[model samples]
Target chain A: MTENSDTLGATEKEIMYATHHAMVKSGYAELSISRISDELDKAKSTIYHYYDSKDALLLDFLRFSIDRFESTVNTTIGAHPKGDLDHIILTLLPCQLKKEKRQLHCVLVNIMPHALDQEAFREQFTEIDNRLKTIIEKTVRRGVRTNVFRDVDPAQAAEHILAVIKGAMCTRLTTNREAATARARTSLFSYIDSHLMA
Target chain B: MTENSDTLGATEKEIMYATHHAMVKSGYAELSISRISDELDKAKSTIYHYYDSKDALLLDFLRFSIDRFESTVNTTIGAHPKGDLDHIILTLLPCQLKKEKRQLHCVLVNIMPHALDQEAFREQFTEIDNRLKTIIEKTVRRGVRTNVFRDVDPAQAAEHILAVIKGAMCTRLTTNREAATARARTSLFSYIDSHLMA
Candidate 1:
């Protein structure tokens, strides 16, 4: 195996991937180590060896999810025109409509309640949220400078945007994902256009 | 005991009450019949007599929480004039700021992830959410007719309002409850005012 591959062995990676799949399928509350081990054809001890406890396993999976989300957003933005704020928002949101992304969001929101209960998890989740908020804030500020967005407070606008995205995620998880995504994009674009400075 | 009192004996009430307390203190995931029985100094069978299973017990608690939320919102609105939409929105939000209301929200949001996994729970939760959305939509429409709100689509506005409330709840659960609650209320009211006809 390559050096990088040896650092994160196939078994460990498989375990993390399996856990993520299980969480997305059944939710965090219903996930069990035994089920994961059964799927991986590994003993429970092996899973425990990789992760001290179920919480540890979950925390690792959440961290991985956040990292993947950040990368995906960044890559999508990087591949497009840098200063197209509307395009950036439009592109990033539709990604949520994808099967994998939707599942990831399900797992994220599902774990949120428990995450709030754990100090470490709460801090980590908040950190990720703040980072995302900062990105949106910066984007909105850029839009304002270019007269693409109105002179509203960037922080507040960012919060509103985030709220819409989160709400859309919840609605999508419960109902038709395609319809919810379409509505969210339409509503969001309308809000942006209406609020933008001519 | 009176006939009405005899129907729900002291022990049954004690078990239910204890279960509620346990959910508030430790969350729904930590709740179990044995734990409730232990807390109430009753036998497991005695607790089972009141609830068929842990799922049923939790479902009852969830229903109770939803009812309390609905009643609180209604009561808050009723305390003011019928057409005073501003007062209604402002009054209803602060009720969520209270400790008890926040706890109930915690439980509600927490169970959403598992809703898909549990058919009965999902149906109950969906009904509650739909009812809440309807109430908001009706209030917004009334505000529009009375010139208290702008000519914006009532359904969209209602959904946005619900989104803000859910976002605020998540923020409160993840961070400082008081601060999140205050900020959420202020932002929501401001958005409403900004959109209303001058």
Candidate 2:
């Protein structure tokens, strides 16, 4: 068994990758592990050995998603000078540049309520939400201090921005990507310009 | 069977009502029909008779929700003058005054994606989305023609407004209602006023 496990090659990796993608796209609630096993032409026990349960697999997928999002946003925002709220927001909010980010947005909007209802997942979700909120709040506060943004409440503004970004991404998930991108960018910039202090 | 159904009476109605509330709060994907039946102290068959499948049951709940929201918005907006966009927007957006509207907002934000995946439910969801968008577009066009709004693309602006309203409602669903209401109203009015002709 150890030798077989050692020889488990690219096919096993492909199977797990496919399972994760399917789960993210359709949701874990609707996903069937047996179907995933069948798709991979792997034994159920082998799949079970890789993931203790569907919930465990979902958690892994979510962790990967959260990390990727945090890193992407960090890289995009960090590329610009600090306190450039418009640049930071423009980079993060639009769904055109990154497919993974859009998928993450869909999962976030669709899976969050169910995730919140689960006792084990509640704290993890709360932490992630707060972390994202904190990043936006900090940027808004910086903009206010620099007179780039009006004297709006940073926390409230951050929440609103996040909501709009999420909503725009949700719209894109079901509509034409190019059109959604254009509309989202225009609307977001118009909003920022209108809201910012002269 | 008809006599037995008649005998079931208000009890079944009460059970369905409770289940509907629970489904809205938790979402149809996560709702437990068995638990709902247990709570009602009724056989699952009784519930099944009224709702042939979970999809049917959820669709019924959604239909009830759509009717309630449409009526509430129509009545609230009708009470004001004919071309008052701000009044119409304020009345239509989910807030504390209309608890049912808030619940419907939750259902839309949480369940619409799952409904989109179901063939039977997709048309209904699309109809509701298109109907709401058309109404807003018509109002924006009226506002522009009356010289109340600036020379903007009415369809794009209408979609943006819908995005913001829906975004705000999604925020309200996940956070404190009072704060969410205050922020949504402020942002909404600000957006509308900024676009109006001076």
Instruction: Go through the candidates in order and give each one's C-alpha lDDT.
Output: 0.64, 0.60
Quote each prediction's TM-score: 0.79, 0.68
Model 1 TM-score? Answer: 0.79
Clashing pairs in 2: none
Best by lDDT: 1
Judge candidate 1 at residue A40 and give its lDDT: 74
- Cα distance off (Å), candidate 1, residue A121: 1.2
Error of 2 at A104 (Å): 3.2
By DockQ, who's the top model here?
A: 1
Q: Looking at candidate 2, what is the lDDT of residue B52?
A: 77
What is the C-alpha lDDT profile of model 2 across A12-101, one tens digit per residue? 555556666665565545567786776667787877776788766555555556555665565544422233555556656654556555
* lDDT minimum window of 10 residues, candidate 2 chain A: A1-10
Go through the candidates in order and give each one's DockQ: 0.33, 0.24
TM-score attained by model 2? 0.68
lDDT (0-100) at residue B36 of candidate 1? 83
Please, what are the lDDT tens digits per residue for candidate 1 over residues B110-181? 677767456667666566656666777787777777766667787776666666666655766764334445
